[model samples]
Target: MSLRVTFLGTGGAVPTTERAPSAIFVNREGDRLLFDCGEGTQREMMRAGTGFGIDHLFVSHLHGDHVLGIPGLVQTLGFNDRTDPLRVHCPPGTGDDLHDLVHAVGHQPGFPVRIEEVGPGDVALSADGYEVRAFETTHRTVSQGYVLEEADRPGRFDRPRAEELGVPVGPAFGRLHSGESVELEDGTVVESDQVVGPPRPGRKLVYTADTRPRERTVEVAEDADLLVHDATFADDMADRAR
Candidate 1:
């Protein structure tokens, strides 16, 4: 499985010519997910060639710089003749506000738009082999972070050892690799563990938009492959940032 991340926008509350706002595009095994849709996010996506096939959008907060681009993106998707539904996952109690933002122009897109509210410790989105979980963060408003974690994969297959155990190089190998016991032609049962190593952990990425330094973030970001946090303030403004 291929996992890649593209930072569409990474500007502060006030965007500049050099940067846009807070938007992140994650492609895991061809399943695209947008973290935050700030202003000009659609243009950034087009420039980056990320495409408009993203079906899920996760919002950390309702700040303008964090979610103001939804209306435009939705309209663009409609213009592109998108017929698939779009699911927007956001913080609890902000679903109505986000729904309104999607129709800020007093019109709905041709496709369906569903706004899902997820709280801290709740599972925001569940995919085939992974799940996006929500976590608490220290922000001025009702904000939360997200963690995209894949499921544990099976251990490496021991081909040499399996051959030594009289396991033929055929469908039995696949069965063993999938943690299934196989019975040889001679009625010898070969356990999967004999040819499979321990289970390995999957990839994990955490995103916390516009939040202060907190122990909860540390705990949730432990052992993560990528950590996207808020760092708009400089070290000199640490007191004010807090």
Candidate 2:
């Protein structure tokens, strides 16, 4: 599977006509993993042809422009009869913020919503394929960035090599591919190392929501196919953004 990233918004706290706040969409296979639902995120997703029903949302901070549209987006999805469970990951105080916002918006408590507060550590979401790790970022609040990755990859197995050596295909083939020697019908042994290639690396995407330039960001983005950073102001406004 391939990973595609789309920048929904790249502006700072304020939402301008030319640029919105910080938000991005990481397309893993077909799942839409959204990072930071800033103002106009849902609209941007609609414009980008990203259908509704976002199951995963990661927020960096509780800034108004960063999180104000979350309730509306969830409500919009619910209104559209989307029943997929939504999981939200954010800093320590994000749960309270969400609860307050939902209450303010008069949430009926029928929508499938799950809010999780994460710190700088590994977050095991599921075993099928998706996993996210939250790392602390140097921002005004308890901000964090996330790395979303996919697991479980099937690589090519050399079946012709085994057949050339007169090895039969059976459960023994499975064992051989799992790095074990398998005894064949005619007392022939087959080794896994001879028929299997190296494991394929999983795809990864990193999002740096809003932060002053830091070395950790660079390290996290190393070799990542897609790195989404916030350039709110030009290089000259480095001091102001900090």
**117-182, model 2: which lDDT tens digit per residue?**
888775825535768888777777778888776674645578999788777777767776777877
Report backbone clashes per prediction: 0, 0
Question: For this target, which candidate reaches the highest TM-score against the unseen true structure?
Answer: 1
lDDT string for model 1 (156-237, tens) is 9999999999998999999999999999999999999999999999999999998888899999999999999999898999
How far does residue 202 in candidate 1 sit from its true spot (Å)? 1.7
TM-score, structure 2 vs. true = 0.81
Q: Would you estimate the TM-scores of all the predictions?
A: 0.93, 0.81
Worst 10 contiguous positions by lDDT, candidate 2? 121-130
Q: What C-alpha lDDT does candidate 2 achieve relative to the native structure? A: 0.76
